[model samples]
Target: MLLQIDLQKEEPIYMQIVHQIIEGIAKNELKPGDDLPSVRSLGADIGINFHTVNKAYQILKQEGFILIHRQKGVVIHPDAAYLANAAYVEKLKRDIRPIIAEAAARNLPIREMEKLVETLYNEMKGE
Candidate 1:
């Protein structure tokens, strides 16, 4: 899996790592049981600190997106699909609430926001 990190972006490096890894799963680029680079290795590859990569990995593991093993290392969660439950939906809503609020505050039409979401969804799915 490849993660592209933009140092100039507003989001933190660790968040970028988290988002891209999740996107890779969505795109079918990273499958269940697929091995991921070690935190130190990935950090060096992406030109970031090891702790940043570790933070992202810990979050992914906590959220059921990845699994960490002492010998096998890290891999996509075998039962990752179960992550899309009601609680996940609620969390998703909470996460995107700020963006939706900003769009509303800016007077962007609902249709436009819907289109934006559709476009991003398709792109993430590699459609």
Candidate 2:
């Protein structure tokens, strides 16, 4: 997977890594069971500390996005389908509500927001 990082961004480097990996999965650039580069290797490639990559990998493992094997290293989770359980839905709402509210505050129309979401969904699905 190709990861792009901006040191100037306020977001942490590890989060930038996490978000890009998730986007790669969403865009089907990374498939289930695909082996990710070793943390040291990735860090060297991206010019970051290995610990930063390790932190991102740990977060991904905790979130069921990837698995770390002693022998095989890191691989994408084979069963990574998101479960839309109540807790997940609530979390999703909590995460997205502020963004939607910001859009509304900026006077972005509801229809425009809906279209934007639809476009993003379609893009994710490679439509």
Candidate 3:
């Protein structure tokens, strides 16, 4: 998957990597067991420090999104489809609550927020 990093954005570079990789998985552009570039290579390609890519890779590994093999390098997790366990659901809720709160604070009605979410989700799925 192609990744575009914006240095001007307030979000950190590693998060951008994490988001794009996950989005790629969501879009089925990155399939389970697909090999990924080494962290050093991706960092070089993105013009960022290797440690930053390492951090993103570590998070993906911890979250069961990717696997690093000593000899094989990195690949998308083969069981990625089984990742949405109870803990993951809770984490998802926790991660999104702040955005939901911000929409409420801005007086974006629930229906509007729902619509916006649907649009984004559909776009991500390439539907």
Per lDDT, the best of the predicted structures is: 2
Residue 99 displacement (Å), model 1: 0.9
For residues 47-108, could you state the per-residue lDDT of candidate 2 as single tens digits?
A: 99999999999999998999999999999999766766898789899999999999989999
| Model 1: worst 10 consecutive residues (lDDT sum) | 79-88
Model 3 misplaced stretches (Cα beyond 4 Å): none
- lDDT of each residue in 1-127, candidate 1, tens digit only: 7788999999999999999999998888998999999999998887889999999999999989999999999999998656477888899999999999999999999999999999999997788
* Alpha-carbon local distance difference test for all models: 0.92, 0.94, 0.93
Clashing pairs in 1: none
Count of steric clashes across candidates, in order: 0, 0, 0
Q: What TM-score does structure 1 among the candidates reach?
A: 0.93
Error of 2 at 5 (Å): 0.8
TM-scores for candidates 1 onward, in order: 0.93, 0.94, 0.94
Give the Cα error of residue 71 in candidate 1, in Å: 0.7
Model 3 steric clash pairs: none
